[model samples]
Each structure stands twice: as structure tokens, then as C-alpha cells.
Target chain A: MLRIEGLTAEVDGKPILKGIDLEVPAGEVHAIMGPNGSGKSTLSYVLAGREGYEVTGGSATLNGVDLLGMEPEERAAAGVFLAFQYPVELPGVGNANFLRTALNAIRRGKGESELDAMQFLKLARARLKELQMSEDMLKRGVNVGFSGGEKKRNEVLQMALLRPSLAILDETDSGLDIDALKIVADGVNALRAPDFSALVITHYQRLLDYIVPDKVHVLMQGRIVQTGGPELAKQLEASGYASVQAAA
Target chain B: MNTVVHSGAEGFLHRFEGLRARLPGQRLAWVQALREAAAEQFRVAGFPTRRVEAWKYTDLRPVSDAAFDEALTILGDGDTLPAPRGERRAVFVDGRFREELSQIEGASFAIGSLAEELPRLEGRLGALARPAEESLVALNTMLFEDGLLVTVPTGVAGGVLELCSLASRSERPSAFHPRHLIRLESGASLTIVEEASGPEDTRYLHNPVFEIELAEGAVLTHARIQREGVKGFQLGTVYARIEAGATYDNFTLNAGARLVRNEIHAVLAGPKSACHMNGAQLLRAGQHADTTTVLDHAAPDCASRQTYKTVLQGKSRGVFQGKIHVHQVAQRTDGYQMNQALLLSPDAEIDSKPQLEIYADDVKCSHGATVGALDADQLFYLRARGIPEAKARSILVEAFLQEAIEGVTDETARAALESAVAGWWEKEAA
Candidate 1:
């Protein structure tokens, strides 16, 4: 479960997420649709504890554990994952090795036995196949020389490997074609379960169609203006953010 | 003469006359001439000072003042060598070639001591190293004791040859100078792995030089790994010259010694020849490693590359100086040089100078130098996956060095160097 109450944050001393209040219970996928400057990414970064984002006020917690007080890695150890809109390129790190290291790191943090190279490779290959990513991508450097679609799928791949309880997909559907959108959606949909939850941040309803959400929240100007059933997405698509804001 | 007061270079000159009788090939005229000339050069340029452009970043005064003598030959029966991954291994204890300790695979081509083959190898000894302006190389030529002579006949693929220099346990601070000569005839090829190591507590100086000559169409791969004693000091140099259509590849890994300087000079003498000079240096506290290279492109259409990476931890210091010289006639020459350093600690320091002197307007040459700490973005990327900060830092450093290590074409050599890097990571983690 994820909860945010008046989670105000700032970047470069400029207020962004003024006062966001939201909750995503277990076994549900939530969609946050907003305009370009609605602080959607700012919210995700604050939750993930990325440096340079000052939490001005309010609190955010996962399962009653304070998330803002943790390091980026500590938050990850506490089952918080943020899939960046643009995955950072590691010039010389192999993708397979990165996956294994991340998996083992989380495993060790949780007091579980770490997976050896063989076990990690086996698990990675299976999940990569499901995401339609070639095994060659495993040999290449992480996110290096990768296409836009492959980069997004790699984010989903990490989500699969770490199996985080709260995955904040920041603009996961920003740069995908129809086919790439379907594959990425398939990867996310496959991970849908009672224990797994995601905050799919997007500006379009196309991705929401592929990975249908249980709750749709219209985020406008750093605040969630409206929260409704899945049909709220369709209504917003037909009219726009202006009409949605007026109605709210 | 008054200026040579208890200085390192003066110390060598003081013992030169008495040590001449113990020197190998003492009876040979050309060998004696070389010694006299080199000794004269060393005396003229005492120990290089900071004012010297080449020695600007490295100060040799601290450990250089210690008295050094010939290591007493004390071979321990319990001292075992790692399995010879090469076809033959010419092992040296202290500065003398050990017949019983060495492993010579077969009689393929002429392979023996320079002392025994002095008459035949006299003219070829310093032929490749024409420019001995580097005082250290000149010093090595003067006090040279014993080394190996590996010659590959035309068109013969000389299997991997490991030239090993092992310093036996010595009570007092001692020194050794080994002059290794490698000559590959036209169409011949060889892979050489040179390893230098010594006892942990034995304070010594190992000054080694490699003279390499590749004829037209010859290919030679030289991988040198220096894991000297922590209390030891090493001043190693490689001088290589390649002819038409020949290929020369040299890789070095510096992992030990309290102070070390691995210098390489490569010349492309003919058209269409290619040369690759690469190395990696890993240093911890109280350690200093420097790798300097000079690549000369004398003919057109020749290609040369130099990549050196250093990972400095604790209060260690690392330096890299690479210079590419494209001569007037070397049109169409392609030369690339890069030096990158990763400073793990705030006290760690790196000085990198990548230079290009292009006389040929038609040539293409590029040089790059970078001094940076572990990348924050890369660290966050790894740590965000639940990896601890220390582990993430190690992974990124390994990745940084592995990029240059991948340039080593020989698979086994790459693996050996990779494991060495991994071993460094483990030690740092501990």
C-alpha cells in the first residue's frame, strides 16, 4: 500500500508538488494523468528520495514506514522502485550483470540468500523473453545505445527482478510507439497481482487502455483534482484537462 | 661532481666501476661501449627533477636516496611459481637468470640469455631503443645484469612467452636491472606475458627494460603485469619499433609497488602498420603508479592507439602522459590517445597529460584526458537497485577500467587482467 498526505516538495527552491493527497491500496493499479507541468515526476522523485528534491511539508509512507527519511538505496531496500522516464546510461556495465547485482542486493537486504550468476541469468532470460527483449541486450552496456522502447522495457525488467511493492512508473509511456506500447503494457500487466501495485504516470490515455487501471486520478497544477472509476480516463480523453478541471 | 651528494643517480655511478667485473658479457666490446655511453648519460642527467617536463608529476627523491646493491642470490626451494600459462617462462631471481628455476618449453627458435648470446645479439640489443633520453632507460642499460633473448624466425607464430622477474628475499635494500630483447622477423608473430613480483617485506628496486623489433608484416602482442612487493620500487620501460604492415599490441597492468613508472615508446616505421598501447593502474594508500607512452607515426596510413586508465584509492597518486608524434611524411596516419582516472578518495590525485604533435596536415589525431571521481549518476543508478554505496562504487570503477581492458585482443590475457581488476575490487571492498 502507498499513501501520500499533503506531500509538498520543491526543486531549486521552487515549489512543485504543492499538496498532493493520494492512496493506492494493495492489488490495485492507479493512473495519474496530468498536463506537462503538473509535478507528476516531482511527486515520484520525492517518494523515491532522489537528492536535490527538498520535501517542504507533508509526509509519504509505504505500509506505515516513512519513505522520505530513507536513502535512494534504502528506499529500494524497503521495496520502493522508481522507473525513471529516461533510464540512466551506464557506459560499460553489462545489462545482465546489472540485473543480477540489483537482484542479489535486494535479496541480501531482505535477509534472503543471494542468487548466484547461473540462477540470476536464468531468471533474467525468462523475464526478458516475456518483455520481448533480445538476449543481446543483456550483453550490451546498461541502457547504452538502446532504443527508446528498449529503455522503457528495461525499467519494467528491473521492476520484475526486484519485485518491489510500490513501483512509481514516471512517464513510462512517454516515448513508445503502438507496438512498443503494447509490449511495455504486457510486461506491466503480467506483474499485476494482489501484492504488487504501481503508480502509472502518464499524460495520455493510450497507455491506460493497454494496462487498464482500477482508479483514474486527474492531476492538475500539483494537485489531484478528481478521482473516479476507470471511466474518468475516457471522459478526460474526450474533453481535455480544461473541462476535467472545470467539472471537478 | 659536488652536486652528486648521496643522490640516487650518483649512487649508481659510484658502484659502476666495481660492478663492471660482475656484469654479464663484460668481455664484449659493444656491450662495454653501451655501458660507458649509458653511464655517461645517467651522470649527465642526475635524477630527473620536477623541472624536467617528463618527470613533472613524479618526485623520485624520497625513496631514491636509499642505497641499492645487487640482490644476493638466495633461492628458496619453497618459492613456487604459478603455472606457466605460456609456452616457455624465463625466470630471473634477483637479476640473474635461474636455469633450474626457468621453464623453457622447447628449442623452437633461439631463446636464451643475452649474456651467452652477446656476440650475436650485441648489435640488436639497443637497436630498437635508439632514443634513450629517458634517464631511467639509460640507467637500465648501464647497470643491466641478465635477461632473456627470444627470437622468432620469419613467419613463425611464437607461442605465448612469459618473461618473469622475481625478487628473492633480501635483507638490505637491493636492486636489479634486466634488459629483455624480443625480435620478430617478417611475418612472425608472438604473444609475451611479462610479470614482475618480489617478496613482501624485501625492499628493492627492479629496473627492467624491453627492446622489441617487429619486421615487415610481423605481429607481436606484449602484455606486462607488475605486481611488485609493497616495499619495492619499479622503473620499467618498453621500446618497440614496427616495420611495414606489422602490428604491435602492448598491454600493462600496474597493481603493486610503493612507487612505479611504466614507460612505453612505440614507433610505426612503415606504411599500413598498426600499434596499440594500453594499460591500467590500481593503487591504494602510500602507492604511486605512472604510465607514460610515446607513439611515433613515421609513415603514411599507419594507425596507433593509446588508452590508459587509473583507479586511485586512499592517498595514492597516479599519472598518465601520452604523446603522439606524427612525422612530416606520415600522411593519412590515424592516432588516438585517451587517459582517464577515477579518484576514489578525496586525497587521491591523478595528473594526466595527453599530447599530440602533428607535422602532417593530412593526418587525423585526437587526444582526451579526464580526472573525475566516481560518477554520481552512475552511483545512484546502481544504488537505486538496492546495492550498497561501496559495492556500487566498486562496480563503476571496474566498469571504467574494463572498457580499456576490452581492447586487449588476446582472450586469455584479457581474462588475466580482468581477474586482476576483480582482485583489486575485492581488496578495496575488504
Candidate 2:
């Protein structure tokens, strides 16, 4: 469902991701573990089509379609989602209203019928309940004054509502407590289907224990240096990235 | 070399002199003296320019150069009052109050023309009619024909009072000086919504002045909505005095005029008085809007809060100058002021100066001003959520202005102001 080959990205003339190759088939989950500044977040941003990140030499495709050429909104409408490491706080935009707009935008782009306010509210209420969130969250401004765990859960809620085919979780587990980590993992695990794929980016092996990735890759200095099964996470957590860096 | 004295400053002074000479009834000595003093001040101050420190960002050259003749009497049939929308309506046409169209239903309310009330309270007129140092205020005082005077009796709950000023004409460059005097007696509570509108194609000048007096323990909610014509020029001044234990709240929304200036001067005269002033200005195209305010804390334990937001697009310009002054005697004073501007276009400009002057060591005062374009990261975040770029920008802009609008106490008036803001956004996009 998602593929990246020779992805060389640079920010501010400094090459961050030298070369990256990754693939996640439908119904599979791939975990990318890296040290700080090893371009774990850069890969997600590049895949999400954020501006100012120069893709010097790379090709990223989703479902055999070139994702690099699309705008951020276009990529979103094409079923690409990025759960931000830090969710932005929109001071006046209500959470429910923003979710409805986003849902309708994606649905309209795909030639689907748009949901009315009543329908949108019903759908949002059920999703919020499923995520163990209160209806009061819908009335407040989007993520404004939200606790760290609440922001992470809100991001998962958005992913569930949008139902993007390809989801990139960039450091989504960094700030989550143990309970929040389980809730977020449950959210991700529930969305795992034959048509949906995920790229989980994290700095520790803690999140992997909950989500249980199908494949694990060690990213060092902007390149994938090692690949293994779930045991790779355990080895890395036991030995740390210093040995990984020495080996690379 | 033969040089003509531009009619910009002198013509209005001459017309005011002519009006004074034609007065038939016996006038109060203090009223006459105030008129003369205002005329002299107008003559000396002339017109404000960009060189003045206070008016550094706004130049009144266009208004000074325009030949604004004294507006002739425009007495309309009672049918043109635009059907009163709220309780207690006062209509002012061409700067003069129309008693026939006004509706004063309650017995505790007294509504009349300031000119008519001047002779009766000659001694109080001087105290209320202190000459404002600004050139526009001086001009409005010198040339004002008649203004609205409203007073709510002590311990009276006057409900809501609507002051509507409508200027409609296509002939001469008419000018209106609509002054408002509102006195809320002790323990009295009132809500005043000042609505100003005019023909979209008319080229007129509106120089309005509102003087408010809040007795001890009184509460006043004053909201001013300016929807003047696109070709019009508006220069309005609001001077309010708050006594001990009184509460004064003001909200000003400017979405009109080619050039507009709304100045507010508030004084917390007695201990424990509080004042809250908030405003929003949305300007597009070649529009120029200015909001200048000063809060004087003269008594101990007084508090003041101010917030002003401006959104500029196209070639528009916005100016905000807010100052908080805590006197030496005003110990334990708490004052905060903030001015923020969102520049939607590269060519748009915003000049903001938030100042705080505190002579008391025990005072708490702070001021901040910021000018920037929309956050690119936020924009991208919204876009990634499948929201379009235009809608994302509007959402952010609305968020930026929401805090100011939330300060409006009246729900209906607040909704109206929000609608006005939405209308401005629609026009700006078009």
C-alpha cells in the first residue's frame, strides 16, 4: 500500500534522509526506529507532502500513485494521513467542526455523498465515545489547552474519523502515558484492515509492545541500516542505538 | 505668488461661525464660551498629519483636502427611520437628533438633544464639554449642530437603548458631528448599541463624539458598530468617566469607510472602578482604519483591560495605538493591553504601538503588540486535514478575532458584530 525508494530529502540545505527504501503491504504494519535527528520525523513529513522539505532524489508512491507530486490536501484526499508528533492547537476552530470539514473535504474529493450536520454529529459522537473521549471535546477549540495525552488521543480520533488508507504515526507514542499508549494502540489496531496500512515511527520499543509491528527496521544517520522481525525491537531496546551506530 | 487657503480646515470653521451667529434663542454663557474655545482649538490644531506622534501611522490629508460643506437640514418623513429593531431607539440624521422618530417608552429614561439640554445645565456643560486635544474632536465640537443626550435615572434598569445614526445623501460633501452623552445614575444598569450606517455610494464625513458618565456603582455596556459607506470618512471619539465602584465595558467594530478613526479616552476616577475596552477592525482594498485608546487609572485599586485586533488585506492599512497610564496615587492598579494584526497580503501594513506608563510602584501593567502573516505551519496542518486553503485562512482569521468579540456583553449585539465581520470577509474575498 505504501512504498518509498531512494528517498533523499533535505531541509535547509542539510541532507537529512540520505537514502531510504521502505515498503508496507496492505494489512501490514512497519516500524521505523531511529535515534534523535536520524530523520524519523523527516520521513513522515516528506510522505505527507509538507512544504520546504526538498526531495532531492526520491520516489514515494502510495497504491502505485506518485505521492510526491501531490499537494498536502491532495495527498490527504488520496487517503494519506499523518498523526503529528505535536498536534497543533487551533484557538477558535471547534474540534467537531474541523473534523466535519475535513471529513467532507475528503469525501467530496472521492465523489462520495457529503454528510450533513446531523449525520456528521452522529458519526463524531460515536467515534469520540469509541476513543473514550467526552462530547465536551467536540465543543472546545481544536486541541487548544489539551493535555499531552489528550492531544495524542485526539490525533487518533482524527485518524479514525478520516479513515485514511495509509497512516503514518510520527512519534505518536512519545508523550503518551501507559494508559494513553494502550488507548492509542487500540485505536491503531482497530483500524488495521486488508486495505489499510501503517508506518509507525518511534524512538523506543515500548509502543511496539502494544501495536506489535510485523517488521522492524533500524534507521541510522538517515538510512535504514538493519531490518528484522519483532525481536529487532527487543535487541535494540536492550543494546541501544549506540551499538547500532557503531555497527552502521 | 497667490496661494489659496485650502477650504479643508478653514471652510468648516467659517460655517461653524456662521451657525453660531444665526442662533436665535438665548444661549448659556458657558455653552457659548465652550463653542468659542472649541473653535479656537480647532483653528490652532488644524488637521492631523502623519508627522504627529499620535497620528504617525494615519494621515488626515485626504479628509483635510476634501471640501466638506455644512450639511443642510435633512428632515425626512417619519417613515424613513428604518423600523426600530430594539427597545428605546434614538435616530440622528446629519448630526441632529430627530425627536419625532425616537421612541422613549420607559419613564425613567430621559432622551433629548444635547443642544436643548445645554442651557438648562450650563454649569455641567463645561465639565462634560472639555475640549479634546485631537483635531477631529475639536472639529466635531465646533461644527456639531445637535447631538443625542440620554440619561437613566438612579437605581433604574433602563434595559437596552439603541442609538442609530444614518447619513444618506448624494449631493454636496456633507459632514455630520453626532455627539452622544450618556449618564448612568448610581446603581443604574443600561446597554447602549451605537449603529452607524450610510449609503454605499455617498461621499460623506461622520465625526461622532460620545461622552459617557458612570456614577458610583453603575454598570454600562457600550457597543459601537460602524458600517458606514465605502466612500465615507469616519472620525469618532468616545470619552468615558467611571466613578468609584462603577463598571464600564466597550466594544467597537469597524467594517466601513474609506478612512476611519475611533479614539477612546477612559478615566477610572474612583477607587475599585473597572473598565474593559475591546475592538476589531477588518479592512480591505484601500481602506484605512485607526483605533487609538488611552486608559487613565487615577485612583487606587482600579483595573483596566484592552484588546484590539486588526485584519488587513489588499492594500489596506491598520493603526492601533493603546496606552495605559497608572498615576502615582493609583496604587494596586492592574492594567493590560494587547494589539494584534494579521496581514493577509504582502502589501498590507499594520502600525501598532502598545504603551504603558506607570508612576506607581505597586501597579501591574503590561502591553504587547504583534504583526505577522498567517502561520504557515498551521495552514499546512489544516490543509493536510483536507480543508481548503481559503477556508483554512478564514478559520485562522476568525480565531484571531474571536477574543475581541467575546468581550461584548450583549448577545444580540455580539452576533450582529460577528455577522458584520463575516460580511467584511465576504467582501474582502470578492
Candidate 3:
């Protein structure tokens, strides 16, 4: 449902993602592994339509729609979600209120009726349970004093509520403990369906153990150099990205 | 003297003389003396101009240029003012106490008018409302028409005391000067909610002053919400004295008027006293708002915390000047202050100065000021979450002012403040 053809991007006038060609069809999970500064995060940002990231060359499409031409909110309404590497701390915006607003925005975009407070709360509570987050977290400000793991789990909770068609997890496992990693993976795994897809970006293969991917791609020097199956993840985990870099 | 262009000064002095002649029938000798002295001081200092250091950002030209006539008594025609959601209620109209319009329900304390009770507590009033070099205070004291006098007796507690000041104009260029004196005896606890409102579209000025005295071990929570008429102008001052082991918490919200200045001066007079002052200003269009405060630490181990937030849009202007003074004897004093402003339009302006003057060596004092527009990155983040740009901006703006509102100790008051903010957001969005 997602396609990128020779996508070249630049941030701050520096070329970051150069000629990245990839495709993720419906009902499949893809893992993009890369070293630091290999354009992993940049790719996620560009897909989610973050500002200041100039699209220099090529094109990206989602479900046969031009994604680059739309605003961030429009892209989100078109079912594009990015789990930020570092979630922002919104001091006074309640988590439940923010989530309800986002959920209704997306729903209205798709010609659906908006949920009221009660209905929103019921749906949010169920999603919170799935993500192993307490109900009190909904009362506090969005991610104000949440732990690293809780923040990641909150991101997963939002994804579950929004139910995006293509989810991009940008370094979601950077600060999670083993248990948190498992819970986050469980949340993602539960959302896996025939029509849903995700791009899991990480440096290690540990998160892959919980949410196994159908395709694994090695990204080095702003380009995807190699593509393989789940076994390639184990190979890279055992030998590190040195051999992958050498091969590239 | 030149009798040509000095007509305004002559009329002002004539009003002062008329007020002095009417004072004997209103109060005792000491009170009359105090008024006379204050009138002399006002004559000497006159009104502050833009050249004054403290009044630089605020120009009183429009107010001074207008011929201000002495407020005449126009009591409500038996229609009492709306009672705030509290037990005790006091109402003042045109700077005169309207006994028939006020209600003091429940047996918590003694509440009366300053004209009646000032004689008994003259010494305390003199000590608390000491005449300052400030011209505005002098003017308020000299021509003060009526005032509220409240005393929460020792060990008294429960329920909030509401003070409502209503100013309506039957004639053009009229002004009201309402003064208040509140004393919380030792071991007393109380909450005072002051509300200032006026007739819609009425062009008037409401100059109100409040002096609060807290004895040892006293605790008082005071919240002032100013939602006067858009054509009204307000210049209100609050002076509070905190004694040993006492605590004073104040919150001010200014959401109305063409020009409003709410000044607060809190004095930590004894050891182990604590004071917290927090507020927010929401200005739009041609509105101008200012929240200036000065915290004085006179004894050791005193603590003071202040936080002020301003959100300016269109051609609005906001000013926040917070100063903390720690004397030599105020060792181990802890003072923290922060002022932040969000400018939403190119014509919007905010002058924020957070200052600290410390003479004690062993003190922890910090001040910070930040002025900026909304974070583009955060705005994009919210927009990318499927939230509309307008709604996303409102959420961030609400978050920016949340810290100040949440500092309010009363839940109902906090909710009221949040609703006020939501109303402002709706207007801004439109």
C-alpha cells in the first residue's frame, strides 16, 4: 500500500535520504535497519510530512495517492502515522482529550461520525488496557512526566486509537526495557491485519523477535543496500552492520 | 497661579476638599487625618506619566486627558449584584458600600464596611495601609468613597468570602475608587474571591485597592478575576503582609478592559512565612494588560514563588514585571520567578522583566524570561496527528497558560479559569 521511487531528501540543506526505493504491500510488516545518520529517522519524518525536510528528488505515494503534496494533517488523515523518536511533553493538554481530538479528525476525514466524550472514553480505556497503560495516565498532561517506556507505550496507544493504514515506528525501542519492548511489540502485533502495514525502524533486531517482519532491509549511507527475510535479521544481529556496510 | 490651563488641577483639588468636608460625618478623627495626609500627598505627586520608570510601558495619557468627574452615588434599584459561588458576599457600587445588596451567610467571621469598623481597628489599618510614594495609592486613599472591611477571627475556617465591586456609569467621565481592608487573625484560615465587573459598553474607570494583614500562623487564599466591561479601565493594587508561619496565595486573571493594571505587593514580615503569586493574562485586539508584583522578604527563612504567563494577539500588549527583594536579615530566603509570553501576531508586544535584588549571602534566587512565538515543530507534530491547525494551536496555547491556572488551590476556581481560557481561545480562533 506504500511506494517510494528513488526518493531523495535533504534536511538543513544536507542530503540525507538518497535514492531510497522501497514498497510495502498490504498485510506485511517491514523492518528498516540502519546505522546512525543512515536517514532512518529522516525517512520516517519525510513520510509523515514534517516541515524543513525538503524533498529534492523522486516521489512517495500511499495507497496510490501523492503523499508529498499534502499537509501533515492531510497526510495523517490519509492514514500515515509516525511514532516520534522522542515524544514531546505537552504540559496542559490532557492525553485523553488530545487523543479524542485526533481520532475524531481522522474519522471525520473518512466520512464517519465523531464520537462524544463518553464514547471516546470507552474506546480510549480499551486501547489503554491493550497497551498496558493505567487510566490515570489519561488524566495527566500528554507525556509530561512519563517514563521512556510509558511514552513509547503511549505512542502505541495513540496508534491503536487512530488506527492508521501505514504506521512508522521511529526508534520506538530506543529506551524501552525488555518488558516494555514486549508490551509495545504485543500492542503492535495485535494491530497486525490484512489491510494494515508498518515500517519498524531500529538499529537492533531485538524488537524483531516480538513482531517478526516479512522483509528486512539494510540501510547504509542514505540508501537501502540489501533486502532479505527474517533470517537476515538474525545474521545482522550476530555479526553487526560492519559486514552489511562492507557488502554495500 | 495661571488659572487658564490649570482648570483640571483646580477641579481635582476642589473634589478633594469636598470629600474632606464629608469625612467627619463618615468616620473618626484618625481616619480623617489619614485622608487629609493622603490628599496632600496626591496633590504633590499627581498622576504618574509615561516617563516614570515603572509606568514606561503603560501610558496614562488617554485616562489623564479625559476629564474625570467625581463618582456620584447611583445605588442599584433594589436589584442585588449576582452573588459569587461562596458563602459571604459583599457588594460595592460606585465606591460606596451597598448594605442592602450584600449578604453574609453562615457564622464564620465578622464582615462590615470600613466606614463603620475603621475606628475600632484604626491602628491596624494604619500599619497595614501605610502611605507610599505611589501617586495612585495616594489618590485612592484620599478620594476613597467606600471600602470593605473583613476580619476572620482566630481559629475560624470554612466557606469563601466574596467581594464584588460593580461600577456603572449614569454620566460620562465618572470614576470609582473602592478600597478594602482584610485582617486574618492568628490561626485563622479563609478564602477570598474578588470579582470586578461593570455594565457592558460603559466607559468608566474602577480604581480599587486592597490591603490584607495576616497574623502569625494565618493562612489565606485570595483570587481576583477581572472581567470588567471592554470600555472600562481598571487600576487595582493589592498589598499583603504575611507574619510568622503564615501563608498567602494569590492568583489574578485579567481578561477584560481596554487597559488594566493589577499590581500586587506581598511582604514576608516574619520568619518561616511563605507567599505564592501566580496569574495569566489573555489579551486580544486593542486590549492592554499588565500584572506587576514585588515580593519583599524581611525576615529569614521566608519563601516566595511567582509565575506569570501572557498570550497576546492582534495589536494587544502585555507586561509582566516581577521583582523579589531579599533584605540582609533574610538569610536562607528562597525566591523563584518566571515570566513567559506568546506573541501570536506581528503587531503584538510583550515586555517581561523578571528581576531579583538580594542582599543576603545565603539565599537562593532565580529569575527567567522568555518571549517567542509558538514552536513550529510542535505545531507540525500536532497537525500531523490529524488535528486541525486551529485546534492544535488552541491546545498548545492552553497548555502554555496551564501552569499558572493550575496553581490555583480551589478546584471550582480552576475550572472557571479553564473555561475562561477556552472562551478566549474560541474568540481567537474565530
The list of candidate 2 runs beyond 4 A from truth reads A241-248, B1-7, B21-30, B72-85, B98-108, B112-126
Score each candidate by Cα lDDT: 0.86, 0.86, 0.85
Cα error, residue B239 of model 2, in Å, equals: 1.0
Q: Write the per-residue lDDT of candidate 1 for residues A46-157, one digit (tens) a residue.
A: 8887778999999988988899998888889999898989899998889888888898888888889999988888988898888888889889999999999989989989
Angstrom error at residue B425, model 2: 1.5
Per-residue alpha-carbon lDDT of candidate 2 for residues B1-430, written as tens digits (9 for 90 to 100): 3233333778788788678865422265665666777777777767877778989998888888888877775544431444455678888887777777788766468988887776665554435445657767777767666787878889998777778888866578888787678889998988887788877776889998888899999999888888888889999888889999999999999889999999999999999999999999988889999999988999999988898999988999999999888899999998988899999899999988888888999988888888989999889889989887888899899989998898887876687678878887787668
TM-score of each: 0.94, 0.92, 0.90
iRMSD in angstroms, per model: 1.0, 0.9, 1.0
Better-scoring candidate (DockQ), 1 or 2: 1
User: Model 3, range B19-42, lDDT digits (tens) per residue?
Assistant: 677752245777677777876766
Q: Compared with the true structure, what per-residue lDDT tens digits does model 1 show for residues B1-430?
A: 5354336787788778788877877888888899998888788877777789999999888556888887886867644565677668888887678778777758577778877777887678888664248888778888888888888999898777777788888788888888888899999988887778888888999988889889999999888888898999998888889999999999999999999999888999989999999999999999999898988999999998888899888999999988888999999999888889888899999998888888998988888988888877778778888888888888888889988899998876777678767876787678
lDDT of 3 by residue, A153-179 (tens): 989999999999999999999999999
Q: Which residue pairs collide in model 2, if any? A: none
Q: Residue B359, candidate 3: how far off, in angstroms?
A: 3.6
